[model samples]
Target: MVETGTGTLPTYTETLPRIPESARTARRLVDLALTVWDMNEVRDAAEMVVSELLANAVHHARCESVRLTVTRLSDSRVQVSVVDRSRAHPRRRAAGSMEESGRGLGIVNALAHGRWGVDSLAWGKRVWADLEVTSGE
Candidate 1:
């Protein structure tokens, strides 16, 4: 993991293969970062957000691997991001009742409270979600 930040805010980053199993590792990274920062209040949400982000990359991106970054934005907020070599941005689509897929972004949207978006990079794109830690965390 690479740790970098300005003063108190810390960011943790890891590069993982673009495979389904990588989502588990991504979630673990999220859990560890939030736990160490004493931001357990948002750990679960962060984990889910990371999982969905990584899943999107694994299923859609043609890259061999993806970079996951969990950054502490503030005392009560954290941002989870996945960078992949796919320029195709994500789109929100309505899923049928029997559909098993197409709900990942929706889940991320709800978990992040609509605080998620994609950043287009020169080589690819970055999908990120911001989770706000509740009070008393």
Candidate 2:
């Protein structure tokens, strides 16, 4: 079972298969949540953040499925998280220009403005990033 963060704020979540195609579903989830919250300004960054997080879980986690969550942390911020049955924490690595991979976390970090981290669960881990909607949005 997934906790919806005390049920205080609006949230969207779905359990997705551990496949590449699920990333698209996760992105749509984020888009939907942000749209409903009237936070479209951060929709693009939130979508990209969720995509990277979901891609990492799909490619690296040894599980049948994963849980994706999008929670409104505040009026100006939202949290995107991916939970998988893998305890191994994600690592950020340097990728060369010619490399086609190893840049997922880098993109998450940039888009989230360093407001991202992983939480260890008894069954797995939750990787999350916070996207803030700037003023005048």
Candidate 3:
């Protein structure tokens, strides 16, 4: 993979309050970034991934704010990550068919084609997902 600062892979970041209402805003941010980066190919999946990650941060991370980062890695790959002020990392577990929750990471894994993981930050942790950029119909 090429380095991010070669001017080919544009990036965007936004720090938002950790509130339930911020989830919608986060999705909109992803959509807008994808549009700006001309990576609309993966907008839907990227939006879903952002929403899930942001929602998890808001609901689980007992922090004041979170940062959302979106990077266009290439013509066909983009990475979305969320950083929060909590060390608690997310885990994937088998979700029962009838379960109403506990499936955010699962959805991310499926959408990202198993290209996702979490990293610990100085103050918290960041969860990221890399998804294929395709102009889906």
Cα lDDT, all candidates: 0.92, 0.90, 0.85
Per-residue lDDT tens digits for candidate 3, residues 1-137, read: 11244555677778899998888888887888778777777888898899999989988999789998888787778899999988988999898999987899999999999999999988889999998865553
Kindly indicate the candidate among 2 and 3 with the higher lDDT.
2
Give the C-alpha miss distance for residue 27 in model 3, angstroms: 0.9
Winning model by TM-score? 1
What clash pairs does model 1 have? none
Ranked by lDDT, top first: 1, 2, 3
In candidate 3, residue 99 scores what lDDT?
A: 95
Judging by TM-score, tell me the better candidate of 2 and 3: 2
TM-score of 2: 0.93
Model 2 lDDT per residue over 1-137, tens place: 23355648777888999999998888888888888889999998988898899889988899999999999989999999999999999999999999999999999999889999999999999999998999865
lDDT top scorer: 1
Q: Tell me how candidate 1 scores on lDDT.
A: 0.92
- Rank order by TM-score, top first? 1, 2, 3
